[model samples]
Target chain A: MYLKVELNWNVVIPAENLDIKGLMLQKAILVRLLDDFAAKKATKDLGYLVAVTTLNKIGEGKVREHSGDVLFPVSFTCLSFKVFRGEVIEGVVHKILKHGVFMRCGPIENLYLSNQKMSDYQYQFADNPCFLSLKTGSRIEKDVTVRCIVIGVKYMEAQKEFQAVVGLEGDYLGPI
Target chain B: MQNKSGHFDAILLCFRCRHFYNLTRVFFLACDAVPFVLSLCLRKIYSRLRARLKLSFNMSAAGEEEENAADLKIGDEFLKAKCLMNCEVSVILEHKYEQLQQMSEDPMNQVSQVFEKSLQYVKRFSRYKNPDAVRQVRELLSSYQLAEFELCVLGNLCPETVEEAIAMVPSIKSRGRVHDDEAIEKLLNDMSLIKKFE
Candidate 1:
């Protein structure tokens, strides 16, 4: 069983004379963790911890200040779990290029499925878009498994484009 | 005597006014001196900061260049390997005239032409002013030829071996042969010869 959790929080800043009189005062926003819903846990289970900095103030009020949605530039060590060269993992086709197609599983960016990897599909690059075949908007909600093949990884030191090979092989592909 | 006392009092008043004026001048001078001192300190700080920032920028730029050079070196190694392999394959083909006879005349001629052109280019390009660069190029050529020989043998037996051959080739450098679209296309096609792994 997998546990999905969403945490909501509101922070209050005490009003001061400087704040009331329209003098700009720096406000330090703090992120707090409420609770975790655990489906499965071992001996030692650690809860999620987050550190945040306020980018911009969206709105202010007497009782509470309404800050705009928090934006985080998240970085991950592993984009996807390592599978065998031919094994398929379910993914949503995110983008299509002349060279390849990019797919997304969860939070990972640009898992490539090259033109050569598209098997058994009559992909017309010119007229109707191949990406439209996946029906991105609707397919995103559905769980689709894709084969994660280990193609050549091009490591460009200058641009830092780390491309990995992932594809939908044969007739076992498409939206569910 | 009474007029003399009145004259002394007038002189005393004049003296006090002059002292007051001098004090005011000194106060103004001090006020002006404060900013001058502050400005000197600020200028010194700014110069130091500017120097540090410039140094950092220079270091970062140098680092980036070094990284690019390293990447280029890797690509050069791959290219040298491919060239060497192609040379060896050509030699092998020369040894197997019977098999060559079996191939179509047009393809055989085309392959021979391409092989000869590659060899000539490699030979010409290897002759650099720098002996070290020449030596490096030669070493790369030999290794590349050996890898190509291995790939040719493998490719003849199995289709998967073609990928190894393809991987040996490096990314096309846009330098030299500007306005030569044919050459660029050939280079790109060569690089793409590697099949996407399954």
Candidate 2:
């Protein structure tokens, strides 16, 4: 899911980056803010901070005593993507393993739907490995779009990434 | 005596919150117990516990599919945030990327991996390409006063029938049963109509 989240953070500018003109200083602050926003990536609260849609405010910059760097309190609204359990999501199968298939859903790349989760489908050891459904004879291979419900989600604090365990057990949830 | 009175005020506050929240969806009584037995030290613990309980409340309401992975929750902070459908996100990201390309000499460096992947995902999944169709879809669904999450799910998936819609988002069906099958059917039909015309 994509969310428009308002956030307040302090953006720091080195002494060299500061300009004489007010407009130039403002431009520098925005550039620094965008750079920081991209670098911050995902958070435990908000999944992935994709892009800054709008800059709502740039509060008065305060100079630090020790470093002489200026700190500006920036308030902006950005787009974020987070997936909740039980939410039916569509993903493109990228890699097929005997145990399961790996799919990418928006910013979430590590969505795994295990073979056990897909009870109706049996794995076939073809030249290109795929899961073949017994009932419909539908094949789940690389690049195929599959709809699955998120069964579990884990956020790795070290990597700042989200990995989910998905399932095709529910109704209307299978290869699309 | 002061602490006792404060405890009563907190309970009254919780009841008022429950009353207001009940109007929207099922109200969980889990957090109501926070203020039942309050002491100076216990009150501090209760405040922290209330925050934790509220987080769980939001998660359960979001539709947990299983028992063990109860930790797979998107908290209330995100629930209240404005949710954009895949088509809408595609438009926004595409527009922002284009603007960045025009403004900066090194636009590729400015864009993050998340931004690139999200753009590709949305572009691939977005059902409606036409901007007007997107707007129409939102307008049609908003008439029902569906939660932002539900609205976006319906818009993104564009489920053909009421049954499919419910299957995709069980919360819509379970949340006080505000939407009947007929209403859901009409919503789906209207969504398809927008897509058809587009």
Candidate 3:
């Protein structure tokens, strides 16, 4: 599910980080202060704070001389996502390929609804490269919210990420 | 008449706390000195007292079968916390939900998959009918200052008996049986709905 995650960040200011913050270092500090804060504060309750959409609250900035970094004690709300097996979720169709369609569901948005996951709908490449049901002529394409249940999820060996393989074979889980 | 002693005792508690570590060290040293024979004798005494207390070691053979010790890794602390005790389906679900949210792998990752499957089964059990009781138990456990793991177990297993609690919770032993028992018994008494059910 989509969520707004609020968390605190105390980013270390390396000289390179300041370089990322062009001219007005003070204004750029808040944006850069949140760097890797999500990764640091990832816990069971808070999950992974993947995106910092807004800086809801800000506190007094403290500059450390030794490290040459500014610490911004701020309370910000962002987004968090998680998934469960056999859990059905609705997401917008982000990409359509000849193989399968991807839905940016929950937090990760790497959920791939493969053809094996969709027993009901057959991929019709002649037209929109969408999942077309031979039974009802119903087709699913980009920008459409499709509901699917997670069947298999694998972590990519090379990347620090997860891939969710969802199934639509379950009852009432095609396009909704 | 009460006005004579009415002045709040502004006694410094630091002086008393000064010996806390020394006293704890002494106690541990004393325990370490106890011989195997003495430990066996103590166990005898404990079993006798437990018999008098009518504590239930009634956890079924099924529970033992469910606990496969070799599978759990060190960081899989949650599984160890849950294996020995009974917990509410919803509470366990919530705890696992929180854990799953932070995990890099899928919930079915092999490292703790047995426990995960067990949790999925446990979630189907109907134990969360009373939200009010659940909330009270949650607050009460935090008030008791049980460790995160202990609180998780306590929130799930609303153990009725002193022995059941002692068996299920390691903190009870750590806090000294008498002190923790009294507090936990009071907590269980207050949660009558959970106390009566199972």
Candidate 4:
């Protein structure tokens, strides 16, 4: 199971007494997080945690100097078996491409349903003349079941690439 | 007796001439006094009118000053609130990033595309990192005419690795537990901290 966390940026120092150089150093920490965590291999323990950071307010330009360090808190959440493959997930049909259907499961997130993965009934129904004539915005009112499989994961160091595989199968194989 | 009648008529005329002249002089003096008295009254009225005009002018000037003071006060209060909010957001982002950095084994190589895109926020914070950096970012943000300071911070906070950036964003822990809007709003609000980057 993955833990879910919510995060945002908060300035530890007041805007009237902020140090610009200090803020830069502090921001560097965020850069490190961007590089280290978001792109890494998914571990069983890590599950599927989503981290988020927000920026709320800023002081005026005239007095921003002498203001303390500007802080940013990146919040995150962990989705256990719910969002993983094989979990019964519900989503809206966002788009239909020549290859497959795309479902928007959550904000800023999307999933792809390849044509090959569609069940025979879905394939046949979609292939029908009436279905083929449907437009892009047409709502799909069908449930799909599929196992989550680690199709491909990539890690880049400088200009190098590394790959990792996670197998998602079993009851995690349906579309809602 | 015939000579006495002529002398008596001459004597009567001579005795009244001087007295009549004195009476005429008194009459002219009274006419002159009337005009002098009217002039004095007019002077007093003019002075009072002039004083009233001066008072009104002074009052208007004072009113303008009071309005200016009120406006300045409002602006100051608003800026203060804004500064506090920005500070909070920056702190939160820093804390979350630190936690993720510690947890990850290979902090450098992770390159999630989504995370990579999000790390652009680091640049936003870069504006507040230093005086010089803040100045530079302020100019940039101003040129773009952006209202939110957080956007500027995000512009400066680009991460070196994409995966690390992705890790910074909180993942969905469970279905129905987190609302995407709430998360995004929080992120946006936190990013506003860039307003204090100066």
True contacts kept of each: 0.00, 0.71, 0.00, 0.02
Best by DockQ: 2
Two-chain complex of model 3, DockQ on C-alpha atoms against the true structure = 0.03
Tell me how candidate 2 scores on lDDT: 0.86
TM-score of 3: 0.37
> What's the ranking of the predictions by lDDT, best on top?
2, 3, 4, 1
Error of 2 at A156 (Å): 0.7
Give the per-residue lDDT digits (tens) of candidate 4, residues A101-144.
Answer: 55443222345655555433133245421112132322233332
- The residue pairs in collision within model 2 are none
Model 1: per-residue lDDT, tens digit, B60-145? 77544432311232223322333222223233334333344566564445232323332332232221323333333334333332
Candidate 1 at residue A120, lDDT? 40
Best by TM-score: 2
**lDDT by residue for model 3 (A1-176), tens:** 22344567654445545554345555566546444543343344333334444666656757788877766677765544334344444556888986789986534557788876677777777655787898888788987877665665454434435567876764455675
Model 2: residues with Cα > 4 Å off, grouped in runs: B1-74, B104-106
What lDDT is reached at residue A31 by model 3? 43
**Of candidates 4 and 1, the better by lDDT:** 4
Q: What would the TM-scores of all predictions be? A: 0.25, 0.80, 0.37, 0.23
lDDT by residue for model 3 (B58-89), tens: 33333333322112111233322222112343
DockQ of each model vs. true complex: 0.01, 0.41, 0.03, 0.02
What stretches of model 3 exceed 4 Å from their correct place? A4-8, A13-29, A34-77, A94-99, A106-109, A154-161, B1-198
Q: Model 4: how far is A168 from its true place, Å? A: 11
Candidate 4: RMSD over Cα atoms? Answer: 26.7
Q: Is 2 or 4 the stronger prediction by lDDT?
A: 2
